[model samples]
Target: MKARIYVTLKEGVLDPAGKAVVGGVHALGYSEVSEVRIGKFFEMELKDSSDGERIREMCGQLLANPVIEDFRIELGNS
Candidate 1:
């Protein structure tokens, strides 16, 4: 089985990287942009059955910062 994880900053958290990307996009003459929120993406192969609890534990433990980040998991067939 395959699994994917997405980590992103919480709603109230500040994202400097996202802001920088927005500026860069507008500088290149694409001024129609509105906003961007930067986040993390991960692809992994899992040997066990797709378990939500275990996956959530992994996210909380190391995949994301619980203090300021949120995560979502996507599971797929191998």
Candidate 2:
């Protein structure tokens, strides 16, 4: 089984890296690009018995910052 985690900044949080990327894109003549936000992606191989609750615990405890970040989990047999 596989677990996928996506961690992203909450709305209204400052993202300097994302902002820098936006500026870089516009400097490359892609002025149409307006915004860019950065996030984290994690892929883990878990035992078949691993449950969503356990995966969520990992996110809440270490994988994501509960104060400024939100996470989503996806589980699959692949």
Candidate 1 Cα deviation (angstroms), residue 45:
0.7
Candidate 1 regions with alpha-carbon error over 4 angstroms: 48-50
Cα lDDT of model 2 by residue, 1-78, tens digit:
999999999999999999999999999999998999999999999999988897899889999999999999999987
CA RMSD of all predictions: 1.3, 0.7
The per-prediction tally of clashing pairs is 0, 0
lDDT of 2 at 46: 95
Cα lDDT tens digits for candidate 1, 1-78: 888889999998989899999999999998998899999999988877668678779889999999999999888885
Task: Measure candidate 1: CA RMSD.
Answer: 1.3
The CA root-mean-square deviation of candidate 2, after full C-alpha superposition on the true structure, stands at 0.7
Q: Candidate 2 at residue 4, lDDT? A: 91
